[model samples]
Each structure stands twice: as C-alpha cells, then as structure tokens.
Target: MTTRQDGERRRGRRPGGTDTKAALLAAAREVFIEQGYDGATVRAIARRAGVDAAMVNHWFGGKEALFAQAVLQLPFNPQELIANLLEGDPDSVGERIVRTFLTTWDAQDGGVFAALIRSVASHDQVANALRDFFIKNVFSQLASVVSVDGRAELRANLVASQMIGLGMVRYVAEFEPLARTDIDTLVKAIGPTLQRYLNGPID
Candidate 1:
C-alpha cells in the first residue's frame, strides 16, 4: 500500500495497520471526564481522538468496555483477582478480598484510582463501569467459590459498599482520619465488616 494508504489504515480507516486502541482510550478518558459517560457518545470520543467511531468499536467492544479501561485505571487486570478469589477458601474470603483490593489500589501510581471514584459520582457511564466491574469481575468470580443460599447479590453489594466507603475517605474526600491512616490500621478497622459480608449470616 502507498504511504498515505498505510497512514490512513494505521489511523483505523482501512485493513492491516497499527491499532488506534491507545489513542481511543486516551480520548475516551478526556471525553468522559468532560462530558460524562451519558453525555459522551461514541462520535464525540472519536472526534476527540481524530479517529472514526468504527475504531472505538473495533478496538473496544463498546463504550462500556472503553469506560472500563479509561476511567477505572485499575493497577492490575481484575481478572487475575477474580481468578484468585475463585480459588481461595470461602470462610476467610472477605479478608483476602479486602487485602487484595487494597494491595492493588495502594500500588497504583496515585490519582488514577482517585480519579475513577470522582468520575463515577458524576458520570453515568463511569458509574455503570464501576458497577459492572464489581459484578462481572469481582463478585461473580467470588460467587463461584462460595454459595450463600440466596444472598449472593446482596453480599456482593455489601462488599462494594465497604470498598467504596474506604475509597471515598482515603482518596476522594481525603478525610484526615482515613486518608492519612496507614493501610494496616485501615485494614484492621474494616476487615471485620468485610469478613461478615463474605461469611457471616445475612439477615
């Protein structure tokens, strides 16, 4: 192909060229933050990235997946945690789960996770991604390991609440008591609630 054709293809206009996945992700992040998930359309993101809408779909399944990659900025691929949760013992699942999550966030390069929490409160798409990540990636994986009669969904939600609350005080609101606190201290304070959510009776 000619240089121009090659360049066009690389920009996601034709077949057999470099993927514009990273560019679309960066654009999606900006658009989502500025316009929010509900307001940010595929066309808008594409326009920001200077690529075609088809490229968004080609690179990411849809806005939902794109939102997952762009907004959350999780330190590790969630699937790995999901797999570990599925393989672990059920009784102590909550503590393990909490520790795993904390370890992941604590290791991030700062602000990425905080940014995600801030976006979720204001952006519908980002909120949806957060919810879906918990359901599909976190809770569902844990469900495979432990069966709690009829409270699986509720259990998942409870765990999310705990995590979100921790995130808010530590990252979003930056509450002095929680923000400045060490991870071990925070873990000791919150681990019991998480333990209950995982294994205690759900009334």
Candidate 2:
C-alpha cells in the first residue's frame, strides 16, 4: 500500500479521491483547451495531472466523458437535459430551451461560453467539438422531437444559429442592453423566434 508520503512522491498512479479527480479535471481542461478534444489524449492529461490514465476511466469513464466534464462543463448531462426539455408541453419546448440555456449559462457568468468560443476560434478540433456538443448531442436531438416534415436538420441549424448568435452577442461582443438584460426579459423576447424555428412550417 502506498502511504500518503509515498503516493505523493511516486506521482505515477494517484489513488482515487477528490484531489486526484480535481487534478485530472484541471489538467483535462488545460489539455483540451491547448490541444482540443481530438488531440488531447487521456495519457497526456493523466501525465499532466500526475495520475494514472486508468484513473480517468475510473472517475470519468473515458476521454469523451472527461471532455464533457472538464471542457464543456455542461450544466447537465446531454441526454438528461434533452429529456427534461422534452417533458413539458411540446409547443413550449422552444421557450423552455431558451430559458434553460440562459439560466445555465448565466449561472456560469458566461465563462463556459466564452471559453468555448475562444477554443473554437483557436482550434479547428474545438470547432468540431462544439459542433458535436451542441449540434449532435443537444440541438439535433431536440429538433428530431418537434421538427416538422423532415426538417430536423434545418431546425437544428436554425436553433444553433439563434443560440450561438445570442451567446456571441451577449457573451463575446458584450453588446448593449442585450448583455445587461435580465434572463426572463431576454427569454420573452427571444423565445417566440426560437419557437417559430422549431415549430414553424417549412415549404
């Protein structure tokens, strides 16, 4: 058994604990940011964190899970979030989506959004990660539920555009009343537009 001092000195395979997990998360975040989701390896992250790569599997299951937690920092699991949004009135999913998004990102004070945008800007892999994160895992699933007449792809694109634009203007550009507006106020203003995107008829 590796004692505390021995474990500290060895630094090869860290025993499971809050500190080891935290170190892995911090290291994963940095590695994902620097190398992006595709390029960032579990071994590299574990090496940086001074832990065994197997610990990543123990704590996070795998690289994708680690990326989701450390880099995406999602407020909720992708599937759970989708399911929750789908539970309410079908017509009102758009509003719920907008509300949930604003509330979650707002709670983080835009740090996650800003970091993702920066990563997407600096790294192509990050852009792909953003696409997979938002488009495949989130928006497309939502669109598949409510979209009309095989328009899931288009609806997904529309929702992504609206949300990404809103995030950019509010978090990145820091433009005027929008950046300062209360969540409910923005939701009321933007909800209908997204509703139309999701529920609108396409010819």
Query: Which candidate's lDDT is highest?
Result: 2
In model 1, residue pairs whose N, Cα or C atoms come closer than 3 Å (at least 3 residues apart or on different chains), thus clashing, are none
Alpha carbon deviation, residue 132, candidate 1 (Å): 4.0
Task: For candidate 1, write residues 17-65 as lDDT tens digits.
Answer: 3446766888887787677667889987876665678888888889888
Candidate 1's error at 46, in angstroms? 4.6
**What's the lDDT for all of these models?**
0.71, 0.77
lDDT of 2 by residue, 36-143 (tens): 656789988887787778889999999877876887755556578777877868777778888888777777656567767776787675577767777666765676
Error of 1 at 134 (Å): 3.2
Error at 116, model 1, angstroms: 2.6
RMSD each, Å: 4.8, 4.7
Where is model 1 poorest over a 10-residue stretch in terms of lDDT? 10-19
What TM-score, over all chains together, does every model reach? 0.73, 0.75
